[model samples]
Target: MTEQPPPATRTQAQRTAATQAKVLDATVDALVELGYAGTTTQEVNRRAGVSRGALLHHFPTREALVVAAVSHLVDRRLVELLTRPRTGHEDIEIIVEAFSGPLFDAALELWVAARTDHGLREAMIPLEQRVTDALAAGCADLFGDRYTPAELELTVELARGLAVSRILRTADADRALVTRLLPVWKELLDRHD
Candidate 1:
């Protein structure tokens, strides 16, 4: 026998899900193309092919949409951070590379916006915390029980400071900065290991 179709209610739910996805995709596009401060509700709505009312219905405020975008970016970065093959079978380099790659780019964009845009920073702090926690947890998992919780936290903080410095650098930028910094961090981890 043939199966029955989804109920009309299910179709409506699916449509809502699809629309929400589009809105989020548009938000990211606007973010990349326009940067966070330049992104507007109208632009996002136009790109998303949703009505202003629909955008408002889904996101309510620009602040809400920006926060959603930050959360989305962080979640994707966390997955990449956790799954990266241990580079050189060296967790330190892998960790540094993870920060210095797309995750770094994302943070750089957000940091510039977060500096002058109060609304964006307000939206980003919690998402930042989650990303930090995930990376620290990964470090602990890599180091096993040899590293204490305090040391793990310090390592995470140092990584964050490095990331921020890379984002905020004015000149003399080079990839070696991250690679160089990793050894100092590795030394700390080594003492505990």
Candidate 2:
């Protein structure tokens, strides 16, 4: 076989992008294990096997890296929420059902991290608003003229509360009780009248 030229090295930009991604991923893993307050840029750099200078070169500040990691995590969850199958239920019920399971777990985890981490609050508020807006838009589509602005806001809040409750009470709450109470979610939409 003829000898081939050596493979070209990755470009500087490509290497930088890869390193940043590694840093972001490592940050997320650290956050998941230790929460936002516990994760540090140094720890992320160590986990990513990149130099501290390389991480700061890409992110410039710890806040920048933390925001990037939060955005990265939310983007993945948003993709899942967007792609999930809709069962064609009423808007409020759909909202309840949509935010269940791992999606809810992730939100709770992120919120808990945000509570203690100032950098996380700066990162999460806008991301969370976007998710709420997307869900509200979907609700508008489902409910059409029947759903008013105030009700939509309440539904969204209720969904968040329910998700939080689920996360907080998962251990003690009875699954059957939750299943039976699911129907009561529609009362809020009905009250919108």
Candidate 3:
């Protein structure tokens, strides 16, 4: 039989999507490593190995790029949380670790910046709402029929509080402390269940 033709090259749309994804990933990395103030388009371009023109074509402004990046990050994290294997015996430590990791740090940076920057805040509101919806969905998926909607919402809120406290440095999130306090939080959640 005659050999099949080689696979068609990537279309321009595919290439554009790939480049946009790279820039968005680089933006997340910069936010995590350098905080909001330091995550400039120039830095993202360098990290993503894409030209400034490409970035501009994909995202016309820094705020637009950052908003897209945060949305992308939150979507990815929600997927991870929803799909992660659960032992049905998870503790506060595990939950905290899950919520207070690199993604949280990057999101925290954006949140803090949004608090003061009107443009950023405007951009972030919809993204934050999407994240909230995803978390609600994730909680329902995780707990299933064991808990009511209100209970599931409370569980998500409790975990978010613990994670936020750690990110904000208002609470001691050390393993020892988390271990000691986990059971108490679980008991509280059990009451809701």
Give the alpha-carbon lDDT of every model: 0.72, 0.71, 0.78
* Sort order, lDDT high to low: 3, 1, 2
Model 1 scores a TM of 0.72
Tell me the tens digit of each residue's lDDT in model 2 across 140-176. 7677878787777877786677766764465447466
- Give per-residue lDDT, candidate 2, residue 83: 63
- The ten-residue window of minimal lDDT in model 2 covers 99-108
Off-target runs (Cα >4 Å) in candidate 1 are: 1-10, 84-90, 98-122, 168-173
**TM-score against native, each model:** 0.72, 0.71, 0.84
Candidate 3 TM-score to native: 0.84
Sort the predicted structures by TM-score, highest score first: 3, 1, 2
lDDT of 2 at 47: 93
Evaluated at residue 162, the lDDT of candidate 3 is 67
> Who wins the TM-score comparison?
3
